[model samples]
Target chain A: MALDFTIIGYIAGTLTTFASLPQLIKSLKTKDMKGISPYFVMSFTTGLFLWLIYGLFRNDYPIIIFNIISLMFWIPLLYLSLMDNLKNKIKINIK
Target chain B: MALDFTIIGYIAGTLTTFASLPQLIKSLKTKDMKGISPYFVMSFTTGLFLWLIYGLFRNDYPIIIFNIISLMFWIPLLYLSLMDNLKNKIKINIK
Candidate 1:
């Protein structure tokens, strides 16, 4: 039963951790991120960073591992979203 | 030291869990979910549900509480995104 729960926890962690990936892929392919909210990415990435620190302090392997992976995906997404937002602002200013 | 880590964990959990909220509010205000990926929501929600179950099995209160709140936000976001996607498809079909 304990092992079963561990399996479930890992699966859950995997799903949530990779959740941002599809959006990242879509944004990369289209180079269009008009609909993605910059605030969302910023908040999430910050959260993930803190989670990593928390995991380290607590010595929680699952939290540490998954959040590291989550950060890998989200940091890029956050960068893209910020860049896209900046581009849009510049375009608006130029116009 | 342990208490400090607990504080960090809660803060991290709160930030990550509520990360989707800004997007949800944006979508609600503008009714524009075009940038929001349906796949992301679907995957994230599934992960949250599983996490909730995992929390229950592990008797982890923080996990259960945060995931439940995350679901409250995400489920609505998921519904809106699906509805928007459907509307877009219908519009395309009519054209």
Candidate 2:
């Protein structure tokens, strides 16, 4: 319950938030999601959203703030990945 | 602050942890990490470790437990990704 430890949690959450940015840039730049797993994307996005809700319930500012920001980073990637998956599926069907 | 809310946090944590497993299974089965971003994996793994530490500092069992378990899931993917990236680098150097 020390204030210092909560600071550490904030830092950890920040790193987790930062870590996803590069991947987002990569996804946006390449527009390639073949290597991206949709199931994970869907699950991760949903889970983070749930975390945001959990944060709201607990009034945990760090959790709410980080999860929402993380969701912002993730949503586009999820959209792109789903689009790619759908396109690939269509291609396979056509062939 | 409420017990029910903490339970929700636990569920969120579990889902976040679970989200990575399918990705791990795919990585193991296909041995393809092209879509897997190493930056995220390393940062996430380190962040989770920090979260574990944060948990210890706060004496919060859930934070410690989920992060350690999440580490177990992420480490292999990180190793595989670094290996794949290294292989590609070596291939480029040879060519």
Candidate 3:
């Protein structure tokens, strides 16, 4: 039963960690980020960073590993979203 | 020290759980989900559901509570995105 729960945790972690991947790929391909909120990207990345710290303090490998992976995806997403938003603002200003 | 770590955990959980809010609000206001990936929504929601189950099995209140809240935000987002996507497809078909 404990093993089963552990398996569930790992699976859940994997799913959540990679969840942002599709968005990242799609955003890169389409270059359309009008719908991706910059606030969401910022808060999520900050949360993941905190989770990594929490995991380190707790000495929980799963939390640390999964949050680390989540950060990898989210950080790049955050950067892209911010840059996109910046470009939009600049375009509007020029107009 | 332990209490500090617990605080970090809660803070992390809070940020992550509410991370989707801005996106949800933006999508609703703009009716623009073109940048939001359907795959991301589906996988993230599924992962949150699994995390809730894992929390139940492990008797982790924070995990259970946070994931439940996250689901509240995500499920609606998923529904809205799907509906928007369907509308777009229908429009394209008619064209």
Candidate 4:
């Protein structure tokens, strides 16, 4: 690949890493996972896992780096989602 | 690439595409775009565009297909976001 093309990949990866930040921020700020979909997050996280694996196999640093950031962004959301579910269950149990 | 590897790619793409569906649905249901981030969406969309282009350049069908579905999921969110912003602005202006 040309230097320019490689640079483009870097740019793309950077943009994607940044793109997921808002959801991360919102999830943090609101602590409300009500509307967020669990299935979607799981699937997206899985996809990122594959992307990370693919990056590793291909030895693509950009892919690896971007996915690392995405994982960081996603894990919290997933954890919060699970916690919300657990809390709801406890409420139901108490009721 | 091995057949197994190709299948993995297919599965990964399918999962990611499905993952984004819930957000699309929620965005549609609530029509609430307050928490969603425009910058993230813009950056993610740009990344998807590049992914599409990269897929085209490499003749990678999986990347292309996944991104198309992702685009479908994202564009509505983006539209809803813009519409909400406009609506809020109009309300403020009327006041």
**Top-TM-score structure, candidate number:** 3
The candidate scoring highest on DockQ is 3
| Model 3 lDDT tens row, B1-95 | 89999999999999988887998898888988888888998898999999999999999999999999899899889998889889999999999
Better of 1 and 3 by DockQ: 3
Task: Flag regions of model 4 displaced more than 4 Å.
Answer: A89-95, B92-95
Greater lDDT among 2 and 4 belongs to 2
In model 3, the clashing pairs are none
C-alpha RMSD for every candidate: 1.6, 1.7, 1.4, 2.5
Q: What is the DockQ of candidate 3?
A: 0.83
In Å, residue B89's CA in model 1 sits off its true spot by 3.4
Q: lDDT value for candidate 4?
A: 0.78
Candidate 2 whole-model C-alpha lDDT, 0 to 1: 0.86
Write model 4 residue lDDT over A21-48, tens digit each, in one string. 8878877888877766677778888988
CAPRI category for model 2: medium
lDDT of 1 by residue, A3-76 (tens): 99999988998998888788778777877676666888899899999999999988899889999999888888
> What's the best-to-worst order under TM-score?
3, 2, 1, 4
**DockQ of all candidates, in order?**
0.75, 0.70, 0.83, 0.58
Alpha-carbon lDDT, every model: 0.88, 0.86, 0.90, 0.78
The chain A TM-scores for the candidates, taken one by one, are 0.92, 0.94, 0.93, 0.82
Tell me the tens digit of each residue's lDDT in model 2 across A65-87.
99989999999989998899899
* Superposed model 1: Cα runs more than 4 Å off: B92-95
Of 3 and 4, the candidate ahead on lDDT is 3
